[model samples]
Target: MMIDLSRDINLLTKFSIFSKFPLDHLEHLLNCCGAYYKSYEKNEIIYFQGDDINFLCIIISGSISIEKIDIFGNNTYMLDFYSGNFFGEQMILDTPSISPYTYKCSTKCKILCLPFHKKYSTNNCKNTCDCRLLFRENLLNQIAENNLLFINKLEVLSKKNIREKIMTFLINESEKCNSNKVQIPFSKSKFADYLGVNRSALMRVLSNMKNDGLIELNNKTFTILK
Candidate 1:
């Protein structure tokens, strides 16, 4: 669907990347960099691994699951991105790049795509130069933070045991949410894939942990009790 520029620009403002941008500046940027809106159904592929990624994709609603498929057809879950989160920011360089992971809709989704190359090709007016600079700075900061998160993901994957892995992941989530009670973003199967564990084993470990009085589990929310 074609975006109603005026109405959607208001929606874009809700994202932190555009938090500092004035509405007029944002509107000008939107004009300079064409905007596209796309919707997908649950379990639909947004982009396959090795697909060209030429634009920044922001989640306007719902969530996306990122995973990699190996030659043997084994799948490894990488991460989940929710509304206001974006992908392809790292690929928005001078050269074209392919996605390393597949992006699939975890639910019905609405996304906005902005062509970064368009922004580069268009000369910025003096009035919007500050807006361009701010946006670049914001993009860089987001990229750095994303890198840190990948490193943290590596840490989680490095644990020696399933119990350790589960605790490590829950602890990280607790820290991120600043609460002892943390919500698990993915379903049990997806979470197991992320942890590189068998779903049955993961469930058994969680049950044991609860019985050990180490944690309290309530649906998707787990509270660190110990």
Candidate 2:
């Protein structure tokens, strides 16, 4: 989608990472960061695992998911990101490690990519740049948050059973929503994929959970009862 500069700045404000960022510095930040926008079609592969890439990416629209493929070609869903959310900070900061996950566009997507190079980022920045300090702070914050997010992903993926996976995910969601009633971000089948469980098995366990009064489920919404 072609978004005019004014509207683009407004939409950027909606992203959690950029919510507190000043609009007056938006355009300059893009310039200093070497930001350029690009679009991808549904199901397109954005960055394959092991590829050499070092650009921070922010979703301007649509969604993307980080997935991994095992040697046997089995796929595991790692995480999902929506509009305004960002990724790749860890990769950029930890440049020695090659990419460890496949980033795929789950829907038609638009994203702004900022290419960061150590040689060009500091020591001799161009004279015209004005948001250098703020931009560096942004990168530090993104890297810090991304590290915490990795830990959260590990906690959820470590569950041993479908029931355990569901419970872990639901409890985490509850903490985020600060309520017993929580809504998952994905549909049933996608949720099964996320938990690394067979779709049928997930549904069966969820059915049992509902009947056992452990939870109430209506579509993606669930309320913990016990």
Candidate 3:
């Protein structure tokens, strides 16, 4: 489906990287880059590892899971996407240019695909000259944000035990939502993978937290009582 440049500009601006660009520049980008709207059913694989690196996709709505599969066929969910986040851009930096993991739609999703220019087309002057610089700058900022996310995940992984890690993750998520009570946005199995622990272990950690008066678990929701 074709999207109107004017309408998409405002939605794109919600992304931090594109927020700095002028609306005209963004509109130029929308014109130059072919936009495709794709829909994925829940649990459907959007792209698999080793898929060709062709386009960068922006999540317009819904969530997706990025999973890393081991040789044993075990899968670990590495990350998730929401609206305003970009995915599949890491392919631009891969040496062999293969996707390192698989992206699956956790819910029904809509995404906008932006294909890279071939041979640096100068057909659209607005995009070729001015908007090109903005694109590069936006990419750089995205890289920085990704690096920060990596560091934060590493810090979480450094916790001494499951309890500490769960606590750290909960506190961080709470802060991000700007509230003490937080609802996990993923399934139990997915959340376990994100926490890098087994499902049972994660449950035990939550139980311990409740016993310690740190949090109250009601169904799937977590209320920080401390």
Candidate 4:
């Protein structure tokens, strides 16, 4: 679909990778990367596990989920990416790479797709272009940030019980948001998926936690009372 490039570019500039780029250079880089935008409706699958992955994607609006579906068709939520966040980096560099998880839109959204090994990026690695160099550094930073988030999820999963898991996850969220009261991107069911727990059990634990005075819950926002 057609988009207003100026408006779209402005939106992208909010991210550090593109923030320092001059308008002209950014446009050139987009052209060199063969960047394009696509729209998805809520719950639409953007990519499935094992699907060929040829591009990196950034969310322009709305949210996306990285998920794993088991043989029995049960899905586990792995991560959420919101506006200005990107994914598909892990497989983007390999020849004939395949997706490791399913990517689904959590809301009606727009995504920017760019080939991993594009002209601008490739040339920048070999030569000196201030804009491209800055972009590379920012891209690497983004990948590292994703890795840290994965580590945090792993920490949450390491807890043995549902209560411990919930506490760990919420504590991590509190730290990330720098507030005791934190907002979760997922609904109860989706949060259960992320925790790899049954929804009914998750709800029960949350109720118990609330009663124990350990946390105060109001819909998606949880305030750690401890």
Candidate 5:
């Protein structure tokens, strides 16, 4: 699975983390790495809970669900990743016995897998080279973002009931859309998963919101009334 390094480097440069790295460094990494392109059908498992981690996966297109499964086989979702996001970095630092989670394609996905040599030992810490610094900065940014998201979810969940959570999510989404009319980018099931609620609860909340005259919903389209 050979790739044109120049082309891929150019595409990667548009990503926030990789953008900070000089193109030369990315090109160098590309040269040192072997890449493969693969696609997965919707809901397909890209890697299992304890699969051998041999490569880092970068999303080229589409989305993936990162999930963790306990020994009892109960699953909890971690996140949904879109294009330009990388996964499996934890594997780079952990032993084979300490597998963290599984990565599954929520939708059809295209990914670039960069296989690393068993003994590759270049630390991409912030204080190192520009490329390494970029990597560290990006990682820190993701951590901060995730922390904020966690806090927001907690706050929402602490509300009196599901109605409040639904209203809050709608208000936030409306603001993000820059208009009262907003179309949810994901399905109700995905929204339920994100809010840590059941689909029936979400539907009930939406119905309650509509009855309260706070919003109007037509299929996936929602209009928040001021």
Candidate 6:
């Protein structure tokens, strides 16, 4: 659906990157960027691996997930892309690079795509030049953080045993929450998928851990006791 540009600008400004635009140039900036909204059903594939990516995509509502498939065709849950998070800045660069993961809408989704035009230069944006620079920095920061997270997950999953993997994963979750009591975000089955473990093995490990008093588990809620 075509939304009023002003209203759409208002929604965009809520994000940190868009908020960098000067108040006076914000509307003009949006006009120059060129954007449109797209809706999708739950479980619908948004982008298949190796597809050409060219535009910035922001989830206006609902959720998306990036699933990575290995050479053996084993699928691993990578990350969830939620509302307010933006991606695909790398696609804007002149160099060629393709998407490595399959993207699918985890729920009914509304996505906003902004064209990354090569013609648009900051030389023309003299008044909002600083804002544009800051916007670039924000994009780089996001990309760096995302890469770091994947590296961290690789470290977590490289553990040799299920108990080691589960405990490492929980400890990382604890760091995010800033507390020992951490809530698992996914249901048991999905949680197993995210952790790259067998569901039944995960259940048995949790039971053993609780019995050993290494941790306490109540459904999805876990408390790191010892």
Give the number of the best model, judged by TM-score.
1
**For model 5, how does the per-residue alpha-carbon lDDT over 1-226 read when each residue is reduced to its tens digit?**
5667756777877876566667787766555554577888999987888887777778888998878787898887755778877776654444453336788898899888866554234343223455545555675676565466556656766777777777777776676668888886578897887677899988988888899888898988998874
- For model 1, how does the per-residue alpha-carbon lDDT over 1-226 read when each residue is reduced to its tens digit? 7788667887889887788888888887776666678899999998899898877888999999989899999888888889988888645554557887899999999988877554345654442477777777777777777677677789989999999999998988889889999999878998898899999999999999999999999989999998
Predictions: Cα RMSD each: 2.2, 2.9, 2.7, 2.7, 3.7, 2.9
Q: Compared with the true structure, what per-residue lDDT tens digits does model 2 show for residues 168-192?
A: 8888888877999999887888888
Cα lDDT of candidate 5 equals 0.71
Ranking by lDDT: 1, 4, 3, 2, 6, 5
TM-score of each: 0.91, 0.85, 0.84, 0.88, 0.77, 0.85
lDDT of 6 by residue, 30-116 (tens): 555666788999999877787877667778998888898889998779867778776666565444647778889889999887664
**Whole-model Cα lDDT per candidate?**
0.83, 0.76, 0.77, 0.82, 0.71, 0.76
Candidate order by decreasing TM-score = 1, 4, 2, 6, 3, 5
For model 2, the superposed segments whose C-alpha errors exceed 4 Å read 1-3, 71-73, 90-94, 117-130
Clashes of each: 0, 0, 0, 0, 0, 0
Candidate 3, residues 1-226: lDDT per residue as tens digits? 7877766677778787687788887777767766578888999987898787677788898998888889999877777878777777754443454677898898999988876555234355543387777776787788787666656667778898888787787787788789988888778787787779899999987888899999998876888877
RMSD value for candidate 2: 2.9
Question: Which ranges of candidate 1 are over 4 A from the true structure?
Answer: 71-73, 94-96, 123-128
TM-score of 1: 0.91
Q: Report how far residue 147 has shifted in candidate 5, in Å.
A: 4.5
- Worst 10 contiguous positions by lDDT, candidate 1: 119-128
Poorest 10 consecutive residues by lDDT, candidate 4: 118-127
Task: Estimate the lDDT of model 2.
Answer: 0.76
Model 5 ranges with Cα > 4 A deviation: 70-72, 92-99, 118-129, 158-160, 171-182
